[model samples]
Target: MSDRMRMMVVMCAVALLAGCAGGLGGGTYERAEARRAMTVDYGTVESVRQVQLEGTKTPVGTIAGAAVGGVAGSTIGGGSGRTIATVLGAVAGGVAGSAVEESATRKRGVEVTVKLDNGQLLAVVQEDEGEGFSPGERVRVVRDGRTTRVSR
Candidate 1:
């Protein structure tokens, strides 16, 4: 690949990585009216476990990787040999790019088990934003649509 083309691909990859980091982060909640606000439930955290947060895997990474890889692989040989190398490189690069995007965007999170005031027990998981909830600590559970969060 030409230096110009390589530079373009690198820039594209960097842009995609920045975009992949979008969406929810720790310690932030959407603001809504009282009626629209999440329904609140009270409980005590019974246990906590650290966990890995999954990042979104989009087609951008695969496409960028394939483009770059194909160009690089095309330099390997002539005609049919080049074609075969390009295909293999594209596939391998696509997979590697997807994995890299996921890892780079992943965040640290925690799973919390709680016991409700009504004797019903529950567990919730969320990003740990320095608001660590220990066992037996009082917590409030809130639900907005299908998403729920636990807070002090």
Candidate 2:
């Protein structure tokens, strides 16, 4: 492919990878979660702390990047020079792609500690979106299997 075509492919790949990132906010729910039964408990927010949620590190991004890079690099030179360029491009692309994926998937979150009406203390971490939580505020702790979230 031409250099321009290769560049377009790379851009499209990056866009696709970015679009694949899903939100973890309390307001966001997986399709499988719909119609599922969940448990709810009342509690008072004891504390709220801002936190950073790490992003996913899947091979899809790295592979896609390497492929795009190799294609782009192949257009650089001839013979051994071209081979070297391809390898370097693939390596650089892989690293950049991983970083991009991580940055794209990362989210702002909060660690909320709540005191249940029964005196049980619990802490839940979830993406910080929609209703914000504050100390001494009444909230609901919703649980679906291993997943838990705090909301008003």
Q: What is the TM-score of each candidate against the true structure?
A: 0.82, 0.92
The Cα local distance difference test for each model comes to 0.78, 0.85
Alpha-carbon RMSD, each predicted model: 2.8, 1.5
Per residue, candidate 2 scores C-alpha lDDT tens digits across 44-136 of: 999999999998888877877887878878889999999999999899888887777788889888999999998999999888895778899
Extract clashing residue pairs from model 2. none
Highest-lDDT candidate:
2
Cα lDDT tens digits, model 1, 1-152, are 68898788878877877787743433565554244756788998889999878877888777777777776777788889999999988888888878778877888888889898888798777777778789989888877767777888
The TM-score obtained by model 2 is 0.92
> What does the lDDT read for residue 64 in candidate 2?
76
lDDT of 1 at 36: 72
Residue 152 shift from truth in candidate 2, angstroms: 0.7
Where is model 2 more than 4 Å wrong at Cα?
Answer: none
